[model samples]
Target: MTASSLTRPSSKASACGCGMKRRAFLRTTFAALCLPSLARGNGPSPLPSFDRCLEHFMAARNIPGGALAILRHGRLVYARGYGWAQREQQIPVQPTTLFRLASLSKPITALAILRLAQARRLSLDEPAFDRLGLAPLPGKTRDPRLEHITIRHLLQHTGGWDRAVSGDPMFMSHPIARACGVPSPPGPRDIIRYMMGRPLDFDPGTRHAYSNFGYCVLGRIIEAVTGHPYETWVRRDLLTPLGIRSMRLGRSQLRNAHPGEAHYYMADNRTAPSVFEEVPSVVPAPYGSFCLEAMDAHGGWLASVVDLMRLSAALPGHGGSLLTAEMWQELVRPPAPPVARDAHGRLNDMYYGCGWLVRPIQTPPGHNIWHSGSLPGTFTFWVILSNGMAWAVLFNQRREANGLPDTEIDGLLHLAAAHVQEWPESDEFPRYYRPSS
Candidate 1:
């Protein structure tokens, strides 16, 4: 269906047999789903108003470009693009237009590690450095805690590097390069070497702090175990198996942009020094201010909304085809207690599982899994509801003002889902899956 059709009422009547308007029926059904008793009923929950709600949300936020895709029971129900992928050229965003996944790259990397474990290539509980045939970077005061860091710790963001205090080591490209005797912008391996010599912010597994460096280390571990580049292995093993062809590691320069990639925009229209000194003095933040290539496992993949939803569907909760059943259970399993509690001393509503953040619901179906990613000029959010429904939204411009943009998106999506009454039976995947010229 066309983007315009998403806002109009369908000719088909409500399947609920009440002769109710599609929108009203959807709103009522979704409201019922919120109740614990009705949640487990084997009824359909379609999101028909998704396109209209997303269009309104983007316009209100002045988002330059975006793509959204929704899935029901692993089937594509809604997929559309909005605004302009390149405003200067008047290029409208298409469903196939690729946008940077940003930190969403973590989940993909986490999947790779889990797959490796399934193949008996590595153990999650083993010391990561030992498995990689490396040692912690030598520091003045040797901290024995480094030896306790495991693959599971890195996946759960409990590897001890706190961005709040010591800052994200992944962004310290120049300093890492200088310290490791690498080129001006250090690669993942060089960054790992530089961080090894430093003391961890806290004891391993003591607390959860988002760490890009931890995933960067995971990338290297993938390389070490497979004896192949992280991207090469992921593309060959994880993505291609699911028929995802366009996802790949992104570049830091527009000139190096992959085919069908959208041009990124910053909210302030500001530029920063390029990661490569030899390049232009200043470049768009998404294009070159940071080294995306070095950000391999943490935040560097570029993908279309369709591809992301496909990945989501392949995940365990939604009857995924990727990991084995046992592996899937392990992926969503929460860290063992005394589980880390929030500041209020209450159990966190959500905890970072292997790669995704999981929030268990008191109602039926148990839990929901999701991941949100952001970089200088990109914002992406992916969520898989407990009832085998999944959706993903990717935007080229990320607004960095007061609160988190993705959190607002989560609210908007909930509103949209609640308002949806009838769903289009036709799948738009075949129509928009191919790249546009």
Candidate 2:
């Protein structure tokens, strides 16, 4: 794809989310394309109002480091980094800095499923367990209701597992590893077999509950159907075609943090029993409390805010580069029955749809779709709206010093943009971060 073709207003979209080939982008951009404008001497950016808002939010929480990129109608308008990415070594966060994308992985996995469906590789209504054809763990009995769970139920988070009631199995790495008779941090297939033996919290497709294990199974399903590893298929068929080059599954240890990845911090400065060991041992909660490798489909991605914003803008609804218009609408439509109602909302405005949190609006005649990610030391947010505006912000710490929640960024970003007297006519996508082709 040419530089002009990437950022220009064009409606050419692929039936499946495949466009740019990786071979065409054999030459990579020198790490950070926006370093001159974003990271080097952050003095007077074009959007100083946004800079102030982000800086204030970080200062109030004493957040170690963060990076943000904003897009309007598929054009990157602003990109910046703030504070130290590694405070101990004085490494500054850059627009290209990669952070663990907790639940934001859901949207990416969900989009992959939609793309596969668009290609007629799978059906949403197909029984998930039937499709995988994997057996339950040795000697354990299978739940009959497991046969009824469908791909749509998993995508909608209407699958039976409820983290609040039954406790999230994805976090129980040690126990699962023990049960599956495998090494510490068992892979996705072992996790799925272990889950198969347990009874679900509720019947499938009856209600909505966010599930990490559900997406984990989706990962294994992708592997089973495509005859390739989940990461291999996603990069080859989904991400590369979308012009995303740097994203990949993250590892659990600090030493394993991907190159250009930010180090993590905890606000409480607490530790937990390392999931990798049977003996009682404490490690930094962010680095060893859970197994990121096990959370591949739901929350294991490492990426920069710039790459995430590119994904948001390149998605079907925003730039028409992924699924067809009909499947895009199908992607957002809330399922029938009680699943349509919001789980935590006071009104009937927002609900979980496929991979995103959906809020239908009146004036725009479309919906606002977004997803947030949370882990021991990471908090990330991505938003794609109907008005052709999108923003992605990522932090190295999950908590704040002032007792403020991570979700606070949601409102502050909106307010900052609304208060802006003017937005630049420039498109940063091409000038700042477009990879060499």
Candidate 3:
């Protein structure tokens, strides 16, 4: 995507929510809704002023359509769709439309683990091997550093393991069992078994890096300790309390609830036929893989913009509904002081805090705490403010475009974040964040 593509029109139209003039608003709205023959389909209502934003994005990239949901303070002030939910049949996206959340599902999964921690069923600092029943293996070829890895380390990515050697096929492949020295994959106890056997990448707590492996292990612990499937626990403990009816585990739930799901896209040229090829109706491989287990403890869940915004606002601290105030505070607080980011959001050395991406908020006066996620054809960005303000942006077209040479979704987020202003109090906007009861 080009800088020009990202640039929002300076002029305002009266009919547009951002206060643009009528003719301009109509043109912008039309552009936002316009889609190619392959992309055309029905979609939900347009968000209040998103006409310009969606128009600019869709026109530049040839994207089919997408959903945008905005929250001011704690309330969902706006949600709208720009393109078709099902392009072939021309099904429009609605407020309830479901999209594969990709890695954004991590925070939800992390929430389940955190809830367990709050209940004292598990401790973040305790050794996960024995607790999850992976201790006392045959050769104990496990990383010496592995012994030191804890639930907290996994949550924060301080576990010292690294990304896969070549393909990073942690999700698509079943080698975790081989790497961790465990038996087969795809069983309830696979993660614990694998972690107990694999060699350590480095000493626990020595450094910070992202690790899906860490969360995968933690997921096993959740089930072992809770005596329920990870998804079942999350639904009963977290989703139910928060009124998040739209979220579901794996592709099966999505297919069942959303037969009219939106089509996901990659940059036309970058994708091979094998990748862009349609996924069969049959559910595919490694059940709890990141892409598959989104509803699991690690990441493969599906949800809508409205539900995501709701989760963002609630924050769910303590014994309260979304998160206890203390948990929320802990979530946004600076990590153990390697002091990664200074006041600005720039990272010198950053680390994860529980499920959040811990970095400086980087406004005039710096704040901290934010998380961003990207996957094949989806992108999601979010920021949670200490003073009770939060914002999220979810867009569905993936791009590996010319010249810029990286993901276009990042550019989309930068554009959205640039125009976003703090939700101002007025009768026109509704308050979505109510304290968790």
In order of TM-score, best first, we have 2, 1, 3
Residue 366 lDDT, candidate 3, scale 0-100: 33
Candidate 3 global TM-score: 0.72
Residue 162 of model 1, lDDT score: 86
| Model 1 lDDT per residue over 94-184, tens place | 8889999988898899999999999999999999877566544555344577789999999988887888899887777777777766676
For candidate 2, the C-alpha RMSD (Å) to the true structure equals 10.3
- Candidate with more favorable, higher lDDT: 2 or 3: 2
| Tens-digit lDDT track of model 2 for 1-437 | 00001111112221111232333211111111112333344466777656766776677678889988998877888888889899999999988888998999988899888888889999989999887878899899999999899999999889899988988888888888999988887878888898899989998988878888899988888887899999999988877876788999999988778888999998888799898765347898898889898898999999998888878777765775778887788787877677765566334556777888777767747877888888888988888877888888899987645545566566556655655678888877765344535
TM values, all candidates: 0.85, 0.87, 0.72
Alpha-carbon shift of residue 140 in model 1 (angstroms): 5.8
Full ranking by lDDT: 2, 1, 3
Residue 360, candidate 1: C-alpha displacement in angstroms: 1.2
**Superposition TM-score, candidate 2 onto the true structure:** 0.87
| Candidate 3 residue runs with Cα over 4 Å from true position | 1-49, 135-140, 164-169, 172-188, 252-257, 269-291, 316-321, 337-350, 360-368, 401-437
Highest lDDT among the candidates is held by which one?
Answer: 2
